[model samples]
Target: MPHIAVIGGGPAGLRAAEILAEAGHGVTVFDQKPSFGRKFLMAGRGGLNLTHSEPAPDFLKKYGAAETLMARAFERFSPKDLVEWCHGMGLKTFVGTSGRVYPETMKASPLLRAWLKRLDGLGVRFCPRHRWQGWEGDALVFQTSTGEAVRFTPDATLIALGGASWPHLGSDGQWANIFGKADIALSPFRPANCGFLVSWSEIFRTKHAGEPLKPVTLSFAGNEKRGEVMITEKGVEGSLIYAFGAALRDAIEAKGKADITLDLRPDLSQEALLKRLSAPRGSQSFSNFLRKASGLSPLALSLLREGQKDLPLDPEVLAARIKAMPLALTGTAPLARAISTAGGVRLDAVDDHLMLKARPGVFVAGEMLDWEAPTGGYLLQGCFSTAAIAAEGIKAFLAPA
Candidate 1:
C-alpha cells in the first residue's frame, strides 16, 4: 500500500487523510499544535457555521476572483454534498435563517470528535507537535516539540497549512519562507473578512464603542450589504463590513482611504423619511424628532454626526443624508486580528488537481490556496471542497497507470 504524509491537521488536511486512508493508503497527519482543530473549535465558540444553503451558482460567486477555479472543486463537492457528509457522520444539521448550515448542537466539538474517531478507525496516524520545516533533498523534514529533527519520505504529500490569520492557533504563515525556497510563487498575505479602521471622534468612540448598528445597509463600490455592525474604538466591524472587505481594502490601497455609505434606516424610503421629517417638531428636541421620525438609534445618530458637523435642517437634505451617510475607512486591521486571510499560493502555481506543478506528488488545499470567501460558512465549504479535489489529484498522481 502507498504511504502518504498529510501535513497540517486542519479541516482540509484531515479531510484529505480520510479520503486517502479510505482508499487503503497508509496516511499520517502531522500537526504543529498539541491537538488538532484548535481554530475549528474556536470558530464554534459562538456557533459552528458548517456550510451554506445557497444555490451552487450563487454560492460559487462568493469566491470572487477565484470563482472559476473554485467552481471545479465545488462542483465535485458542493454544499448539499457537505450537508450529506455531515449527516453521514450521524450529526444532524439545520439551515439557519440566513441560509447557513450548522450542527444541531451548534458546536464543532462533537463533529470534530466524530470525524477524528472515523479517521482513527480508518487506520490514519496522527503526529502532534511535529512542525514541518522544509525539504532535505526529496525527503520532508520536521522539527518535533523536543527540538529534534526528523525526516519522512512518502509516496505522496498534501499540504493544507491554512492561512496567516489566527496565528495563536498555530497557522503563523511561517511556511511562506519554506515555499519561497522551493521557488513556489505565493501572493503576499493580507487581511480578509476583517474590520477596517476609521477616525471616530473621541466622544463617539467612548460612548458608542461596542454598540451595534442594526437594520442598516452598507454600500461600497457597486456592492451593498444589509446587516449589523458594531462600533469599535478604532473603527467599525461586523458582518456588513466583512462582506465588503475586499473592495474596501483594495479601494483604500489604491486611494489611501475608502468612503462607504451607510443607510441608517434601510426600512424607510428617502421620500417617506422626508414626509416624516416634514412634520412639526412640536416640543421634541432635534434628536428626539429625528429619532421618532426615522427610527434612528443613538449610535446611528452619532455615526451620522461623525460625517457632518451640522445636521441639515432641510427635510430633503436630512433625509438624503440619512439614506446615504458617508464614512471614511482609513485602513484595515492587522492580519493577525482578521477572521481569515486573503492571498496564498497563487492559482497558476498549482495544476488542475491542486498539485503544485513545480513540486509533483505534493498537493495543496484549504485557505493555503489563493482563494477567499465571505464568512457565512463559505470558508469551511471551500476548505472541504478543495480538499476533496486535492485528494483526487493525489490519488491520480500515486497511480498513473
Candidate 2:
C-alpha cells in the first residue's frame, strides 16, 4: 500500500483521508493544532450547516467564478451524496427552510467525532501538532510541538490548510509563503463573508450599533439579497451583508469604497408606501408618524436618518428613500475576523483532478483553492466535494500500472 500524507486536519483533509484509507492506503493526517476541527466546532457553535438543499445546478452556481472546477467536484460528490455520506455514519440530517441542510443534532461535534472514529477504524493515523513546513527535496518536513523537525516521504500528498480566516483556529495563511517559495502559483488571500466598515455618525453608532435590521433587502451592484443585517460600530454585517461580500470587497479594492442600497420594506411597493406616508400626522410627532406609516423599526428609522438628517416632507421622496437607501462601505473586516477567505491556488494552477500542476503527486482541496461561496452550507459542501476529487486524483496517481 502506498503511504499518503494528508496535511491540515480540516473537513477536506479528513474526508480525503477517509476515502484513501478505505481504499487500503496508509494515510496519516497532520495538523498544527493539538486537536482537529477547532474551526469546525466554532462554526457549529451556532449550528453546523452541512450542505444546501437547493438543486445541484443552483447549488453549483453559488461557487461563482470557480463553477467549472466545482462542477467537476460536484460530479464526483454532490450535496445529495454528501448527505448520504453523513447518513452512512448514522448521523441524521434535515433540510432547513432556507434550503440549507444540517445534522439533526445541529452540532458539528457529534458528526466530527463519528467521522474521526470512522477514519481510525479504517486504519488512518492522526498526528497532532505537526506543522507542515513545505518540503525538503522530495520529503515533507514538519516541525513538531517540541521544536523537533521530522521528515516523511510519502507516495502522494493532499493539502487542505484552509484559508487565512480564523487564524487561532489553525488557518493563518502562512502556507502561502511556503507555496510561493516552491513556485506554486497562488493568489493573495482576501476577506470573504466578512463585515464591511462604514463611517457612521456617533449618535447612530451609539444608538443602533449591535441592533439587527431584519426582513430588509440589500442591493449591491445588480445583485439583491433579503435577510437580517446587524448594525455594528463599524458598519453593517450579518447574512445580508455576507451575500454581497465578494462583490463589495472587490469593488472596494478597485474603487475606494462600495455603496449598497437597503430596502427597509421590500414587500411594499413604492406607490403603496407613498400612499401610506401621505396619511395625516394628526398631532403625531414626525418620528412617530414616519414609524407608524413605514412600519419600520426604530433602528431602521435611525438608519434612514443617517442618510439625510432632515426627513423629507414629500411623501414620494420619502417613499423613494425608504425603498432605496444608499449606504457606503469603506472597507472589509480583517481576514482574521472574516467568516471565510477568498483567493488561493488559482483554478488554472491545478489540473482537472485538483492535483497541483507545479507539484505532481500533490493535490489541493477546500478553502486552499481559489473559490468562495456564501455562508449557507455552501462552504462546507465545497470543501467536501473538492476533497472527493483530490482523493480520486491521489488514488489514480498511486495505481500500479
Candidate 3:
C-alpha cells in the first residue's frame, strides 16, 4: 500500500485521511495544533451547520468564480453525499428552516469523536503539533511540538491547510509563503464571510452596539438577503451581512467602500407603512408613536436613525427611510477575526482531479485551494467535497498501471 501524508487536520484533511485509509493506504494525518479539529469545534459552538439542503445548481453558485472548479468536486461528493456520510458514521442530521443541515445533537463533538474513532480503527496514524515547514529535497519537513525538526518521505502528499482566517485556530495562511517559495501559483488571501466596518456615531455606537436587527432585508450589488444582522462595536456582522460579504469586500477593495440598503421593516410595504405613520399621535412621544406605528424594535429604530439625522415628520419620507436605510461600509474587519477567507492556491495550479500540475502527486483540497463560499453550511460542504476529490486523485496517482 502507498504511504500518503495528509497535512492540516481540518475537515478536508481529516475527511481525506478517512477515505485514503479506508482504501487500504497507509495514511498519516498531521496538524499543527495539539487537537485535530479546533476550528471545527469552534464552528459547532453556534449549532454546527454541516451543509445546505438546496439543489445542486443553487448550491454550486455560492462558490462564485470557482463554481466550475467546485462543480467537479461536488460530482465526486455533493452535499447529499456528505449527509449520507454523516449518517454512515451513526450521526443523525436534520435540515433547518433555512435549509442548512445540522447534526441531530446540534454539536460537532459527537460527530468528531465518532469520526476519529473510525479513522483510528482504520489504522490511520496522527501526528499532532506537527507544523509543516516546507520541502526538504523530496521529503516533507515538519517542526514537532518539542521543536525538533523531522522529515518524512511519503508516496504522495495531500495539503488541506485552510486559508488565512481564524489564525488562533491554526489556519494562519503561512503555508502560502512555503508554496510561493516552491514557485507554485497562488492568490493573495482576503477576508470572506466577515463583517464590514461602519463609522458609527458615538451616540449610535453607545446605544446599539452588540444588538441585533431581525426580520430585515439587506440589498447590495443587485443581490438581496433577508435575515438577522448584529451590530458590532466596530461594524455589522451575522448571517444576513455574511451573505453579501464577498461582494461588499470586493467593492470596498476596489472603490474604498460599499453601500448597502437595509430594510428595517421588510414585512411592511412602504405604502402600508405610510398609512400607519399617517395615524394621529396624541400626547405620545414621537419615538413611541413611530415605534408603535412601524412595529420596529429599538435596535431597528436606532439603525434607521443612524442613516437619518432626524426622524422625518413627513409620513411618506419616514416610510421610505424605514423601508430603505442606506449603510456605508468603510472596510472589512481584520483577517484574523474573519469567519473565513478567500484566495489561496489558484485553481489553475491544480488539475481536474485536484492534483497540483506542477508538483505531481501533491494534491490540494479545502480552503487551501482558491475557492470560497459563504458561511451557511457551504464552507464545510466545500471542504468535504474537495477533500473527496483529492483523495480519489491520490488513489489514481499512487496505483497507476
Q: By lDDT, who's the top model here?
A: 2
- What lDDT is obtained when candidate 3 is compared to the true structure? 0.92
Q: TM-score for every candidate vs. truth?
A: 0.98, 0.98, 0.98
Candidate 1, residues 1-401, lDDT tens digits: the string is: 89999999989999999989999999999999999999899989999999999888999888999999889997778888889999989999999999999999999999999999999999999999999998988899999999999999999999999999999998799998999989999999999999999998899999999989998999888788899988899998888888888888999999999999989999989989999999999999988898888888888888877746788888899999999998899999999999899988999999999999889999999999988888899999999999999999999988859
Q: After superposition, how far is residue 210 of candidate 3 from its true place, in Å?
A: 1.5
- What are the per-residue Cα lDDT tens digits for candidate 3 across 34-71? 99989999999989999999988999999999898779
Ranking by lDDT: 2, 3, 1
Q: What lDDT is reached at residue 96 by model 2?
A: 88
Identify the runs in model 2 with alpha carbons over 4 angstroms from their true place: none
Backbone-clash count (model 1): 0
Locate the minimum summed-lDDT window of 10 residues in model 3.
302-311
Candidate 1 has an lDDT of 0.92
Global fold similarity of model 1 (TM-score): 0.98
Candidate 2's displacement at residue 47, Å, is 0.7
Residue-level lDDT for 166 in candidate 2:
98
Q: How close is candidate 2 to the true structure, as a TM-score?
A: 0.98
